[model samples]
Target: MARLQLRNLEKDYGGFKAVHGINLDVADGEFMVLVGPSGCAKSTTLRMIAGLERVTGGEIRIGDSLVNDKAPGERGIAMVFQNYALYPHMKVRKNLSFGLRLKRRPAEEIEQATRDVSNILEIGDYLERLPKQLSGGQAQRVAVGRALIKKPQVFLFDEPLSNLDAKLRASMRVRITDLHKQLKADGLQSTVVYVTHDQTEAMTMGDRICVMKEGRIMQVADPVTLYNRPANAFVAGFIGSPEMNLIDADLSGSTLSIGSQSLALGPAMLERLNPKAASALTFGVRPQHFSLVGAGEDNALEGRVSHVEFMGHEVYLYVNVEGQQMIVVVSATAYDRSKIQGDIVRLQPSQETAHLFDRKTGENVSLADLH
Candidate 1:
């Protein structure tokens, strides 16, 4: 177990900066996830921490030791990659013990570590089977076991479940979370750094998420903090499911208008936004935030229904409002398509959950002023 710190971390190729200078402190026994779209330098950041990729300029400290110049094997970190990277011809047990054998550990000690890892990973029955004979999930477990046999100070996972089928990937997510819990209970002070493009993985597994964009860290926050209280337009759009509906907006006196509908921000919403925010703002509302308001000047939106998709759990209704496409999610059991057809639909951001951003800077003036 180790406390990992990346100080002013930067990575560059020739003159192209892949990751700009950024700082993060991962507590001992913490699970931190790095998430973003491709070209965000998440993999490069992970490799740098593991000493597989050299830092362009910065310091990487594991526990009390500064290991910026250490070799990959000397970094005391284990990396589990997307490809599994298991030897097809080697048995699972042999694969797990390969590193120990290379290090010249005693045969008995290597055998014990191999047995312990296999047992913890629940692959004891497949110990004699080769990678060719194992299922995708089993192969990934073997890969994890191989990393565990080394017992490194930190665990690094780079999209480890990307190769598996969707169901297996979902199952592995739970298994990995359970594994972290068990390992912590056993007194291993391990730090985990996981990198993935999947928002679901980022929201579920991390103690803190580092949201990246174009080589810069946009925001570092807990799942709910990043979701309910985003720092910018990019972070808001990147983290949520179905994404938030962003429309060109203006605030006139006390009313916030998006397209043709005027939203009653009321005293609650007004107190939430910038005091000076009276005009020229962007209205950001999540799909689940919209509600059918009563007739008259109350919450209402006139739109044309473009399409509808039934998702078993809920229904997604796509409507064209003010020349913008807006999607709304509703319980399939509560309301059928007949209730939300060509009639003038009324929608409001229930409980004042909508977000407002600056038209130019994209800064979350609404949230920033409140804090």
Candidate 2:
């Protein structure tokens, strides 16, 4: 329900900067996700937004208010931690109603709010149960319910599903997204800021994903845009499931030479390239974009199959192109398992799906002008 803005937000610990100067504006009622690997400053940023960690510099604003100097409770924000953070001695009902009780709300109002949150989260049956008696999923629901009862202007989640099993994580993801939609449908301000290391969660849950690395923002875009038109090689390699294969190649005029093979570039690619400069570039192709081709096919990279992995409907082939290893995905039904390791195969990358990045800076050269 609130627009969140972090202007030049920074966090430093004893001269060591954990978060650099990063700027972002989250629209009102938007679901934003911060995704990256470990030690990427995602949790630190979330904590700063929640007023749990003091900012080293810059400002943290919620709606029209400057909340940099406000305490966590006064900032009108509720947070759900990764570990559930439930009080072991308190029952589910007490845990959910604790915040309201501290504010000294009326008894009937607290009861009604607790009931509403319990019904929304489907944890009404465990109202009398303690945290120790509940399953991991149930405990997580209580933790979220605790935050929901507050009805804060902004919600912050710090890897809230990391402790659950794979199936539970998927189920919880759907539940959380549905909850967000329901809140929006009911005309409530339910802006959310979620932090997760899993790209799957970021892709499915976020309206816009902010990809971070080494305490800096890399790229922020919708899931499809980030996948199809990555801003840089780091974003391209980090967002995809079977990460994009980046191969070193030489660029000359309208042709790209990968290893000993040369592939002609299309007009669109030629327009994106620097015609006067023939330099070393990184050619990126996704696994699914590579197709099987005959030995005599043009624009094909010939390589020996180094390994084969069957993944239900699709198979991933690990091919060795000279000294470099590349992965190609093919339908399991169409692939011949008999041709295993050491088998020679030719893969032709789709020209339209190929990505070109500057070798020196790791920036996507193809998208330089567009972005």
Candidate 3:
């Protein structure tokens, strides 16, 4: 396995810079995922690592060797693309053996490697079938097998599960993670760099996830840290399922005024806020962090129920608080069925979980204590 490093890596398309100077380190045998929305340069960064795209500046290192000038084939990295990228005319056996064949490995070694990969992927039955004959998931497995057979120092996946259906994608996520573990157990090179726009995939698969935006790295942390202790406003809003509610507000002492209404920032939260936080800041809280409270609750924000969505055991309550929309998740059993649209409700934000951010910079000012 190899430890991958990108130091001040950059890429530009003539006049436009697609990747900013971003530095990241992927430890040997680690699964590092680069995730962000479309046009975030995640794919560009992955391509740079794989030597598929030329870096305009900075260093690309695999293990102890600098590989910025190396060809893709010489980088000791194997890449699995979004599309299977398999030769349609080639049977699975040939496709998996193509890399080894190009190197002119022994015929006996190629045959043994093919069998081993096929068994591990459980695609042994379709070894003789053409790429057209396999299902989306099956074809993806073959693609992974092709890379696996190379025994490269690192594995790079560019949204490898995007072409599959939801169910298939879920299954493939587990399969790939398990395969990485199995390979590691067998003393094989199992370092992986996965690029995807899907937050679910990143949260579930990565040992540590790097969130990016506008060609820059936002935050790199484990899933729990990303969720519970987001470093900034962008990350606070992006990593959650329903996404965190980021409302514009004016902070005064220990109170936040949103439109015509105001909520008190409790002592616990006030203590954590950075002293330099601007008066104009964002009030960030997740749907799950808000609780349904009585109408006269002291610190609760009053609003009218704009909509209600019953999601099995949980209900998503959409409220319009002084012209600002906020979502609160409550247990189905606890939610008042009699309360419908237009009904007034009080939503209380959790003091420990609520975040305050600088309006201009999107910096989570309330994260001073978290670090």
Report RMSD (Å) for each prediction in the order shown: 1.8, 1.7, 1.3
Q: Ten consecutive residues with minimal summed lDDT in candidate 1? A: 335-344
- Residue pairs with backbone overlap in model 1: 1-189, 1-190
Instruction: Give the TM-score comparing model 3 with the true structure, all chains together.
Output: 0.97
TM-score of structure candidate 1: 0.95
**lDDT tens digits by residue: candidate 2, 1-371:** 49999999999999899999999999988999999999999999999999889999999999999999999999999999999999999999999999999999999999999999999999999999999999999999999999999999999999999999999999999999999999999988799999999999999999999999999999999999999998888999999889999999988877788878888888767766544333788899999999887756787888998888989999999998867899999998878644433498888898777889888878888864665
Over 1-371, each residue of candidate 1 has an lDDT whose tens digit, in order, gives 49999999999899999989989999998889999999899999999998988888989999889999999899889989999999888998899999999999999999999989988989999999999999999999999999888989999999999898889989999988888888899997557999999999999888899999887888999999999988988898898898888777888877777776776677666677777653777778888777654445365566776887889988787877899888887777755444454555666566367788888877786774545
Measured by TM-score, the strongest candidate is 3
| TM-score ranking, high to low | 3, 2, 1
Tell me the lDDT of model 1 at 140: 96
Better of 1 and 3 by lDDT: 3
Q: In angstroms, how far off is 93's CA in candidate 2?
A: 0.2
Q: Write the number of the candidate with greater TM-score, choosing between 1 and 2.
A: 2
Cα lDDT computed for each candidate against the true fold: 0.85, 0.91, 0.92
